[model samples]
Target: MLKMLLLFLIGAAVSIDLIAGQACQPRSANPGRACKKACTHDAQCRGRLKTCQCDNVCGMSCFNPNLACNDPGPFPNGQISPERGYGQVIRYTCNVGYNLRFGNNRTCQSNKQWSGVQPRCDREYWHFFIILFYMGEDL
Candidate 1:
């Protein structure tokens, strides 16, 4: 009975150690975390937090065209160029009969690097007659 009990305890300890080792192991993939392996293409970095997919490629980050400086930085050698930076200004002009609904001008500040929201062009009521007359010419 004593020998049998000792063998059972040893087996239990080994099993617990194995479980603990597995628990400490790194995960293969996580939504918000970085990639576990190097990727070679964008497809490999498709999850929510884009990571370096290829062996030497850089990861993707948030990018907005309207903002002045939204560059994604450089990629691996011969993979991407780092010379480019993000633009800070975006220009918007209203149509002939439409007036800008938001402020006409916006500026990119030091901390506020994001581009201003696009202003909507509101149609002018006075231009309705002119537009109708122009449409009549096509008929």
Candidate 2:
């Protein structure tokens, strides 16, 4: 009787471990790191991480505007497209009185990419003269 009880306990422990392991494992479709949980829609699975938890099963993450919000696509800088995708890049320029603090241009990497950090458009005091000239103002 003692041996039988010990065996039953061992079996229960192994079964629990197996279930836990499966839950932690990532789905085959998503070869990347495991997301928080399984997702049901694309809204739940968007962004660089690209994973979501929806139905409880490990599934793809959708883009959730409410959860992970971002700037609307991209805007044109001069003649360049700020769209996010391969071979696309975004350029930025400051107004007449301002200057770009960072690189004026950013590119999309092989992996779908966006600006890791938003660039700043600094104010150029020297250019203030130019604006004043155009406006026909003094001081």
Candidate 3:
């Protein structure tokens, strides 16, 4: 049992190393380690891109907006995509017993910001209360 466990551990370590090597072939350091020491000799890490590391990860990122207790979806009752990135479009809808307060389908812009006003999901009961409170004040 001890020998088997040791073998398994060794195999896991080797597998992880192999995977890491392949994933980060440019240098052992992660892509986030931009401008850091990638090699003992500077020349080994030279001549890639301007500002080699520069946080240029494989994919674009978007600032996912707050859903305000609403279920984010692509349509009024559709499901939300698990993945988000640059140029990805997102639409949101309130869950049952709730209403969409504001906002519309928005796109993840190239600047990594979501386009359009942030949306809110307000519970139906609370929304009624809000309207009543405003009406009462006006009266």
Which prediction has the highest lDDT against the true structure? 2
How do the residues 19-121 of candidate 2 rate in per-residue lDDT, one tens digit apiece? Answer: 1243223334653334343444345544764533221222333333234223324332323334555324576666555556656666543223343455666
Tens digits of per-residue lDDT, candidate 3, 96-128, equal 876675664666543354556667665568777
Q: Indicate the worst ten consecutive residues by lDDT in candidate 3.
A: 52-61
RMSD of 1: 17.9
Pick the winner on lDDT between candidates 1 and 2. 2
Q: What TM-score number comes out for model 3?
A: 0.33
- After superposing candidate 3 on the true structure, give the runs of residues whose Cα lies further than 4 Å from its correct spot: 1-80, 126-139
lDDT of 1 by residue, 1-139 (tens): 9999999877543322131232122223442333234333345545554432111011222223222344432222212122222333444556566666655444342222433454666667877788888988955
Best-to-worst TM-score order: 3, 2, 1
Off by over 4 Å in 1: 1-68, 71-89, 115-117, 129-139
Which of candidates 1 and 3 is the stronger one according to lDDT? Answer: 3
